[model samples]
Target chain A: MAVDEGLKIELGKQGVFVTTIEELYNWGRRSSIWPMQFGLACCAIEMIATTMARYDLARFGAEVFRPSPRQADLMIISGTVTKKMAPQVVRLYNQMAEPRYVIAMGACAISGGPFKQGYNVLKGIDRYIPVDVHIPGCPPRPEALLQAFMTLQKKIDGQPLTGPDRPRFLDAEAQGEFPVPVQGEHDLEPTSNPGVWTVPVVIR
Target chain B: MASSPYFSLAVLFVAALGFGLTPLGLAWLWGRVFSPAKPNAVKNAIYECGLESRGDAWMQFRSAYYLYAIIFLIFDVEAVFLLPFAVAFTGLGAAACVAMLVFVLMLIEGLAWAWAKGVLTWA
Candidate 1:
């Protein structure tokens, strides 16, 4: 028994515990997220407001606003993305490392809000890049953002790699109305396609 | 019988250099004390306004720009020299005032030459 205990101690001294120690460290790092200090439009103001004294996002261990994308793990797509700006946003998303998560923070990001009819705005950000979570509101209240953070925490715990029904929105699928992609200038313009069915044909 | 203009300028230059270095030196010392130990790879990078840096730092600018910039700097220095003299002209008496008038005429001649060269036109 004394010899067995001595052998265990020797193995521990030889860096046998390094992997276990690193795993524990990684877990702690992932749990307390340091969001990147990035914002596109109006929703970004609300995101900043969340960090202020009133809402105090620091309580959730996510107050560190890293300016560098390489150092950050979470990206909050907080506003309407125009077609010109879409590619830049996609490039920024791709620059972030894998196991990174995104929080689509507004009705604009989730479904382009009122700008869906506009030619410049993207119908939805998800069309450009994969979204892990969607927080549906014109500009969600800070408390709603706090709730979304809790939802994301639940997602991290669940660890689902790929699935259609991963994130549960408040009004899932935008109050039963599916988002239609704006194809071009003519597509958004008022058309008299009386024969065309209202039922959306999901493009494969 | 009196101190030279060159002697007064030397004193101003030394005082200006001392004032400029004070803030720079304090910032350097403060950074050394509080900054984290820069791991070898991450520390040496040249950050170009947040974007990743690429290519050589030895960038070449157009010669047209250099010519225009030199002209601007010469005029700027002339203004700096003339402002203080203008403020003190009342006390300087006749001989010093006449010397400054000659300097102004020379500056005007230089400006006319530049204008004739078409460098004064907004490109």
Candidate 2:
């Protein structure tokens, strides 16, 4: 009936196709991931450089960096997270539409790097948000970021589209929104945490 | 009614809504069901360059940019009106030609006025 079909018959091949929806879904998800363009410190510069022509992140289909969290699929925490800025970071993450990802792009974002001891610096962004990939470096080189993208793509390929254990965004009811941190006199604290400013509620 | 020609508009309107919402809804559904939800105090907080914001983010901005936009709008309107006239020039009469010339001259006069008033200058 068709040229390819005739060749297939001549080769003695059966054309029965077999695949689950999850595999297809995962394939699509792994291809195009839009990352949030916002960045914090020195690592942000490297992140921008990765998207430029030299490194060319567009080849991996992740070059489109969205300014708005609602449109972004990935959040590359590109710098140190401070106590005051922690709440803001979480807020941005929460604002992002589902099927989102997070990649800690540098030593500062991973564990505060050299600034870990600083009074204002957060020890690690993982303390605030769930990081999917951690790219370890003072400011991870563009090449390293490319490697991280490959790793993340591999992880995305393993995900299932539908099942008893589907993505949190698809579950809807199980979807958790991070609580906005309240700015305290000395430091920032989660409002949901016990006894932020006042005394803890005591039951006699 | 479905028989009406305006029915196409209704279909388009509904299709537009579906087009915009489907991708967003699908993405949200996928993320919520599959992605892990491990939010804490720090995770939920706002991000501001890894530091505590000292004051309110609101600040006064200069309104001088509006003058430039107004000037651009004037030229934009001129082009919009002139583009059709330019394409239809061979079919136009002398009266129409004179009318367009007068219209263009008025805009040039306005430009001259703006130049005289120093609106063209950045200072």
Candidate 3:
């Protein structure tokens, strides 16, 4: 009986600890999230800030900034997209493979912000390529960007890719102006479940 | 006139090792005690600064960056060769100076090739 017990323990040492599909998938997803560093203007600074000391984006498992678009799974549009830059932006969007997400990180990207009236600006980025989330603010605070990321997390968890709407963005026809009501701004104030969504905006 | 080289080298090596080790060791110990649990579906989702991760992160990259990296490598190699001359300048005199000049001329040729190929153009 003792010999059998010893054999069992030895077998345990060699056995694969994660045998289930859920566990394996979770492992792959949590590990290596490559982000493309495509900064066009001002909001790019805030994106850099997210990866810096106070924010430390590495903690969230997305600090790897891949210069190549093919390797990245997330693209943060951090500034204005001018007519000159539009074709380049569309080309970039096409280069990325399926199952990717775009974060429009400022009013400029969300709806061209103050530059909406300019003939050079593309208005909202959704006009060119789909936007998964529109983060408001002249430049949304880094914490707000973090909140946007969490909302993305929730969407990934709950939603299914049934058809066209499954992707994290609104359809071009459904696209709207800046500061589309999505959620509250990030607050350092003490709260029960700090990251929970308070206000909900439905974009049809 | 300079102090013994051996002592100075030893002190420099020890200080460099200490600087690299302390933070690495501290982070290791801290992780052992307080590592967060591995994330699941909910926790592992992509962050959007605080918004949802939308669309795709992948994009087309310009080919100019590769050309720039190649140029950087050429200059980097030139710098390596120049270092030896810098160290032995007083002893090597005019012959070494002329050789370095020749080497720099070769490097400039490579730059000219890149320019002719139009790799230097932003577009």
Considering every candidate listed, which one attains the maximal lDDT? 2
Model 1, span B86-113: residue lDDT tens: 8997799899988988987787777788
Q: Pick by TM-score: which candidate is best? A: 2
Q: Estimate each model's TM-score.
A: 0.53, 0.59, 0.48
How accurately is candidate 1 docked according to DockQ? 0.03
lDDT of 2 at B49: 37
Q: Best-fitting candidate, measured by DockQ? A: 2
lDDT of 1 at A39: 86
Question: For all the predictions, what are the DockQ values?
Answer: 0.03, 0.11, 0.02
Off by over 4 Å in 2: A1-17, A162-165, A172-175, A191-204, B1-123
Q: Least accurate stretch of 10 residues (summed lDDT) in model 1 chain B?
A: B34-43
Estimate, for each residue in B2-27, the C-alpha lDDT of model 3 and write its tens digit: 48768888889999999999989975
| Candidates' chain B TM-scores in the order shown | 0.51, 0.46, 0.40
For model 3, state the Cα shift of residue A110 in Å: 0.8
Residue A93 alpha-carbon offset, candidate 3, angstroms: 0.9
TM-score of chain A of 2: 0.82
DockQ-best of 1 and 2: 2
